[model samples]
Target chain A: MKIRALALALGVAASGAVSAAGEVEVLHWWTSGGEAAALNVLKDDLSSKGVSWADMPVAGGGGESAMTVLRARVTSNNAPTAAQMLGYDILDWGKQGAAADLNAVAAKEGWDAVVPAALQNFAKHDGKWISAPVNVHSTNWVWANKAIFDELGLSAPINFDELVATLEAIKKAGYTPLAHGGQAWQEATIFDSVVLATGGVGFYRKALVDLDADALGSDTMKTVFDRMAILRSYVDDNFSGRDWNLASAMVIEKKAGMQIMGDWAKGEFLNAGQKPGDDFMCFRFPGTSGAVTFNSDQFMMFKVGSDRRDAQNQLASSIMAPSFQSAFNVVKGSVPARTDVSDADFDACGKKGMRDLASANANNTLLGSLAHGHAAPASVKNAMYDVITAHFNGEYSSADAVSELVAAVDAAK
Target chain B: MSQKWWQQQLPKLVLSPSFALVLFFVYGFILYTGYLSFTDSRMFPSNELVGFANYEKLFALRHWKIAITNLGIFGGLYIGICLVLGLMLAIFLDQKIRGEGVLRPIYLYPMALSFIVTGTAWKWFLDPGIGVEQIVQSWGYTDFEFRWIKDRTMAIYCIVIAGVWQTSGFVMAMFLAGLRGIDGEIMKAARVDGASSVQLYRRIIIPMLRPIFLSAFVVLAHMAIKSYDLVIALTNGGPGRATELPATFMYSYTFTRNQMGVGATSAMVMLMTIAAIIVPYLYSELKGSKKS
Candidate 1:
């Protein structure tokens, strides 16, 4: 309690350093063309506010390498003004007092009224807002080549039966049934969709979020593994070690029938000059229509010094502004974290995402994505990643995998 | 007398900073990592002691087991194949063939490139879709299969193939240098004795090349143990950790999985392994060299 008070006092003192000279050095992993374009919107916005943007991009997908860089920089006491962090990672940094207090800006901007409570849970730590939520990314998506599906005379699968039939029919038509990269994280991405689809949202919460042993060991979980086995069979022989973008390229070239990826895959199609409904189509992975597994990309300011607080405030407000949120998420291929934002500027896919996110929010089917470091801490998530990948690679049977996951998560917790 | 004593101590004083740096960075970090293994450190280090719990977990992990097993397969094949290929290349180059200079450079060019370059080039060259299989099928043979990088059982061999392609050329140069160091008078004497070429090599040349063989073996073993990048570039330990090496495993656990303790334990085990292969060879080499 005393530590919290001291932190708040330090935070107040830091906020007083918001002066006229606004030079912000931002560290992030937004190096892809579309992501970079989206990042420019924020840069321009901050520039209008008289702040200079010093870009520090560490290029690696999934932001793992960027986190390593962040850790080293913080240890060296040269923390940047802002960094792109995922859900629990922000909380982890906040716990270590690496993040600066943003409650001053957060309160003035009515963040509590605008930002979803789910995002606020990560944005704030110990009743203090430390990070700004930028955009929401949901994992349960299956992007398909519209031409292949039209030629096959099919639509998006609505359930497990339909999904199997769709994939089988696509295989019979002599196309790669699934465009997939066989990396551990990619495999786990598909696994996350399968778990959400097979077991209901409640089961996903219990098994992934709560790390319940009984839920992990259940036959429902086994069924998910069975589906994963089928999905694994759909990938081509050259899928191993292929980049996620290359897999998307196969779909783009109409060589593959479908891809089970997050909304970020939308950016790849856009980069390829493909329209959403005409060139490709997307849907909630079968049997997970009303449910959503989401992760937000948040920008967190470090405790660099009191001098950079104004630039930090400018960045925080720019990211949360409804105008900036829509413009950014449109290019970045995610929905806005603020419900107040209008989806008028979005495409068919983005509009669908917004509607589904609303319905999922109302129905309480919205859950943090387990595979993307939102639902659970890194230790538990990585443990599950190991078990999931091992099973996918035929290292363990589904039965043994279930037991292994239980033990792994327990040890990690 | 004081000036003379100061001169004697100058070298030690000049080297003290670097010596202390080595002590703190190399040996000090190793001891720190060793200490970290005994704690329950995760994502960040902590002082909370857990006694051999991390080691226990590291051994129990299925991923670590696969990584160790892969190291055994990778190390054995990488060392044995590189040595044989290197020896054959060196012998062939020593035949005084025309354009030996050009051929030597051609064979040694791969050594000039890094392991990363070798792995990537091999990754494309051996890929079924865009590489050898595609080229073969384009020649009107439809059913060509060269998808070892994609197969779970054969992925480690892809790493092996790339590693050999990168290091064997260097090894050839080592053996070639050794062969050049041999006395031509002995060859003339053996020829006068009516000794066959095969017999001469088996009796004299092979035995005389023993020290070079030991040196090559030590170097290759060390390279095999520390091989992380080649495997990463070629397979990235994918198809579900099929080509996982000890180094990759240590990295995954320490940085990605937030299991620093387990990662440290894995690092210690790797240190012990490299030591087991190197310490004896090193001791023998140094002690024997000193005696001679």
Candidate 2:
């Protein structure tokens, strides 16, 4: 027993010596044009810290493929040094004991003070931080052609009634009111905005965030569905199966008036050399002002060999640094997850978002992003996805959607 | 000279690795998945057994209903069209046609490409803005609308059109091989007996191609059941789940939704459906062969 103990100590000492070199493999789903550009910032920053970053970037915007790969690695006891995880994925993985406790890094960096409470909830497992947030993306923004709105003497709407009036005016002016891709996720995105616009933050919180069935079946939800039905009418006939970038292009070409999508749509605008608030305008979806429903792209460091352990910690620290957050989120077209990041390089739209995030945070109304990531468990979210997609496709009635929503939530449990 | 038991078992030992591979890869994984279906596993497989709950959720989903409906439509049209068109193409090519070798390769080349790549090419061809619709409309048909992909009811047929285009070449190759193996003297005898071309093919050639037909049917049916990548690349089970198939649903449920139990259940449904189709087909083929 004494010899075995001595051998274990020797193994630890040898690993401790090897860890100083700092090499880590990181798995992520960030291979898109803009996403790749954003990920470079993190990789570059890590390199400057003398940490080797082994990038295993899986292609897919939703990280569906990457998650599958991650699961295989985790199941095989070969999880990467770090992995890109989001929202409930953090909790889900943490619950499965697949993630290492990031409390050491969190304590060293004092992350608990600055990170948003909702984000903390997602990144924590039983009071220990498990993931490091990179950027906060609000999914309720309405992107519009500023030139078209200006030419038509239109202003951004602040409420549902005014938004409807704007849609009608845009339609009357011989433009497609809503530039939309008829994919299920795209429909779910629009439905999320409608939920925010018609039902307000409280209803969204009660129905989606809090999972209250009564609020899901409320009159406000019915109005939201009615608004979705109206919004459906604004889409062009051939909008079905169109890619999101193509929909964004309609607005870019001045062929359409607006697109209700996440802040990531800014990447498309930027890619087209269009300046925010000049070529296009980004505003909160009507009636959801001062309310931000958000999801953060975060990296969770997994437990690996000692050599990778040092590299993972270094990468985590680098990712949270102010410069890296600013540079990464700037390219990512999202606001910095850290509230203290400088906004001097940000455009007018980004500045507005930063300001909105601050206000929403102060007002205790910063809700989790429902449409994009895990605002609920997988079962409930999928059921909600099906019901919303069906409703948008004109398969389910407004009342039926409410009933289905309730049943879906009940069934999820 | 007597050999030890260990020395005598060496040849069997050499073959054990292959047997173990087949047992594990083919059988073990399938059985493991079937075991997972009985649990309430989410994100990862859990040990807690919750019988039939996942299947219940799958059945309750409207998307699954649409997916099953689409599977039926796509499978029926795709297999039916491929069989008929492939037989016709093979028969035409077999009539001592000019450049038959070149034509055979041209017809069979599509099957060589990956389905995802083929689906992308098909998507472009079927796209309303840049494809056949645009070309036809450019030809001055102002009101022409070839937007079958945009219509929920007809979208499955559009997929079927692409599927048939992809698989017909494979079926044709199979039929061509079958035709080549046919005895030339039988055709000569039929011709001498004053049998018409149509009657000779209908009466003798088709009946002689029964084994090939069964092989093609099994191949196409398996392909149809496992159809996911093409649908994902082309439509992504989109237009609000209108074009979803069971395979895509299973994939989405497994990875995107992270409901492994439900994914396994959906996979089992696909397995059972294929079993239902192929078992009857095999039974009929066996019975017919016995009677003959």
Candidate 3:
């Protein structure tokens, strides 16, 4: 009888231990220095909460390969507990019933109030929250070496004409005016800046967001193409095939005048021991200061069986918690998705991003970054990639490129 | 009677695991992918039927056009150059010259490398700034430009060059085997008739390599149809979609673009094309063999 009682006690202990050690596998493409650093906050928090993290990182900028792995796992009924998703993917996957409905967890944590409206829209399917947004990335920022500008007696260009003159001046001084990476994504980033710079914020919304045919073929788009032709002159001859971080390195070393990239380039600068405002400057590309092109990285929880759902809820609550938002974004080199989160630990550039994000959110200047998977379907995005890259390589005439772009969108539809 | 039945079925039972693997991994996956082509799936498999909508997009994209065009250019050049060069190398090596053993190993070593490693080395050698162009410029041949990999029209040929470097050795080995199989009496007659080296090879030996030629043709054609890794690693279908192949196009559509339906359709199209060519040729070869 005593032995039977001991076995029952041990059974209870084993069941309790099992409940405490639920392991969650997270799949993401955040292998870069800053990205990994940011991911550690969540890892550390999860560990502190007695949850184990099985980290699966796939190294690719595009995140397509990781999505492939995620889909395969889901199809095999072995999906990861959570995965990194972007833009419409939350809705896209949620609609397919691949994502777990986080409504109960969200209500318990009051996630609706903390998370931004735009992000919540993307994260929800039929008003049910399915994903947790991590941070906001603004894609139209132009990073410049402050030392180069100071040494050359130049200031940040505030308009299209001034920006052109600045680029010309930088070139005449024998420095490459643009430290541009020649990847398709980087080229598209430059194009996004061009569109906003030439056409202003409203046109970007109409053409890119709404996919308005007349807006796409407007004289505004022609101006954008023309400016791209000019911007081409600022890049070095051997810019093709250069990685984005390498381009950032050029700016960090003051070898080139500027690089038009997303806010993520700040991480590269920070890694090089360069502080913002002292060594470099971040500003929206000249004529695009009033516009904000944005893409977000969100962590989406998948539907596991009931036993692990509680652990998933705990992580979701931690993600939306104010403390985690601040800590994660400070390391991530991005602004926290929560507007109310403190930017105390943020650097000068990050603080600027926070201020800009708030203002953009308030003023309705937030445009989605198409190439980075916010504005269009993947088919339309890839079609645009082909035409834009072809045009950049000088293989297509402006007229030819415009026609192809329109045709590609129609075909994509 | 039961023991006899067990013994009769033992070999089949023992090999069942491998047969099951082949059925599932090869044929089952192929059918699954074909079924996926008919659906309007994105990010995850959806049962929404969109019936050839994806294929319509694949054909409409300019990058797809460039990929199909590049396949033709690279496929023809790679096979033609590798076959001719491999035959010449095999013939020369068969002369029983000194150091033949060492040279043969050297030729075959390239076939052992992963395309990723080979592509990196090739990219460095072909880079406009750091490669042949730089070396020539340093040597005061300022006008000597080797920028074929950078040139949009000629980038596909650059992939062909890399392909020959990798595969010519294998082809040489095949031709070498074919050459060794020739009867000694034919060479004796050729020498007695005072046939030159070129005349003997062109007239007699070339005709004798018919079976080897057919085998090599099929192997090369299969390689061309499924070429992906080399293009991905080397040019990444770049210089603005100038060096894309059908396989890479299918990969990007299925994986990168998340347009699985389109990707699946392209795969089916590629499979059908291969079937159309290979089925008839294989049938004719089998018939010819039977007649012999």
Candidate 4:
């Protein structure tokens, strides 16, 4: 009986390998509760089209480990059908001729008319579409516990000074003024808004996006560091090594007044069974109202053999479908990548995000976030992380941080 | 004649596949990485040789500097503490104490766990709000403070604490084996010659355990040098890169930061450091064994 079972297993494996025609291997980093559910929407859509999904989840928050695995797979001549990539990384792969051109599918699906230009910049390389963007994650939003603000009789602060005063009020109420994770990326996320608030969108583009030495070393950058220092004082002593979701939980639990993070934090609040407008509130980081610092999640298709090309194209088209984008982004706590998607099914925060994104795109205030690998290349982003984290941790003063920022960016370039 | 040749070549034939695999995968990759270090590689390997520019850039990086400094502090404290603690435990166990078998396994159990588990456990245990500090506070000691893991300057010491906690047990086992291997006759002779317990250990037993000490040092030193997962699990080289080490730096640069050339350069430097330690020890051991 055992011998028979072994023979059957081997025969099944052999047939499985022979029948691996319609399988699409998707490498992604969305393993969190909401994120996993969000990805399932796409998986089910692809599966419905008779294309099997071979899920390759690498669970780093920043998709760093996924990129690492993707590079290894590419180098070994066994690239996945598609890899969930971010800004700059997609173009980097496209430049290396590793990504498969998706212009044929993209044109057929009219993706150019639907997807936002900011996202399209990452989706295309050399006038050919190589990827499909899924969602837009704006990093300048602050999630606050509405109860705490109501009890303290404090409203949302609209500028830097008022924000400081509100934090003081929250501290006086004996709550953690700011819920912040001490990780480098989290610190840099806060810095993204702080830079925008301090110097406006043009200066942010100059200092971070353009890697300008003059803007980076100017007094404006020094003032940005000073404001960062103020934020550092508001964080709790136990903030070190904490994850961003835990920081979000602080606000949700009413132990903290607010947390300055991306829209992804909204997922945490929703996961905790809390309603957005009732239990919590979402607002742009003060003085960053008109500007949206954004990062879009894009799935860059890798060059694969003709046997799997049809399935890969199916996956690309499914990712760009308006229905799939709305369904996925509603659960993902991010706005849909497609501009034509309706906000009727979205909750309060989601609707606001859609409105803000549309307005920001029209006004050309939609800047790529430096913290989220959209403003610059990975090298420059990491360099900025080093300086910003150091400054936030009080290792460097405002003056030292400005000079170090300029030097670090230059060295990275 | 054919049967005789087959028998003579059996061991060589059996070992050749593994030997070839090791040579290609280990040494071949090492040489490849060394070559990549000289090139202008980023995100992926490239053949454009930039010659020593990556090395210059690496040395000038503040992150690299902090990583090196942290390695020194972490490696020194981890190895030193483990040695002292391991020696004490082994000597204590060497005494004809009751339940030696039970105590031995209890101490050695930590060694069975991966550094990742040890690091995570220690991270929670050392965290201020959740672990020791809270536990102490709940015990009515509100003024108690044990937040070293959260502090910038003192976070590296927390890594040393966790690393020593995990590895000292294995080192203790090594020392205990060495102690058991010591000839009973020499110990008896020393005792009969009016040697006290302290003198017996300090002057005779410890002097004879020099080889064990050397072995333990070599083992602990390499573990300290390549400690990536432990640092990652504990502080993640954070609280502002205060606990960054070379291994973590190499990984972040090569994979995450898109600075593969600098990463390879860091890796080569680390390899040289390990070689600087291990080559001399290996030569001495081989020479000493040959003489014996």
Compute fnat per model.
Answer: 0.85, 0.83, 0.56, 0.85
- The runs of at least 3 residues in candidate 3 whose Cα sits more than 4 Å from the true structure, single-residue gaps closed, are A1-21, B2-8, B46-57, B140-143
Instruction: Give the per-residue lDDT of model 3 (tens digit) for A195-276.
Output: 8877778888787778788887777787777777788878987777778998999999888999999998998998999988
lDDT of 3: 0.84
Which consecutive 10 residues in model 4 chain A have the weakest lDDT in total?
A12-21
Find the candidate with the highest lDDT and give its number: 4
Give the range where candidate 2 chain B is weakest over 10 consecutive residues by summed lDDT: B232-241
Task: Compare the candidates by TM-score and give the number of the best one.
Answer: 4
Of 2 and 3, the candidate ranking higher by lDDT: 2
Model 2 scores a C-alpha lDDT of 0.85
The prediction achieving the highest DockQ against the true structure is 4
Candidate 4 residue-wise lDDT at A89: 93
How is the predicted docking of candidate 3 categorized under the CAPRI scheme? Answer: medium
Off by over 4 Å in 1: A1-21, B1-3
**Candidate models: Cα lDDT each:** 0.88, 0.85, 0.84, 0.92
Indicate the docking level reached by candidate 2: medium
- Calculate candidate 4's fnat: 0.85
lDDT tens readout by residue for model 1, A229-330? 888888886787788888999999999999888899998999899999999999889999998889999998888676777778888888899999999998
DockQ for each of the predicted structures, in order? 0.71, 0.66, 0.63, 0.77
Interface RMSD of 3: 1.6
Ranking of predictions according to TM-score? 4, 1, 3, 2
Show the lowest summed lDDT stretch of 10 residues, model 1 chain A.
A13-22
Clashing pairs in 3: none
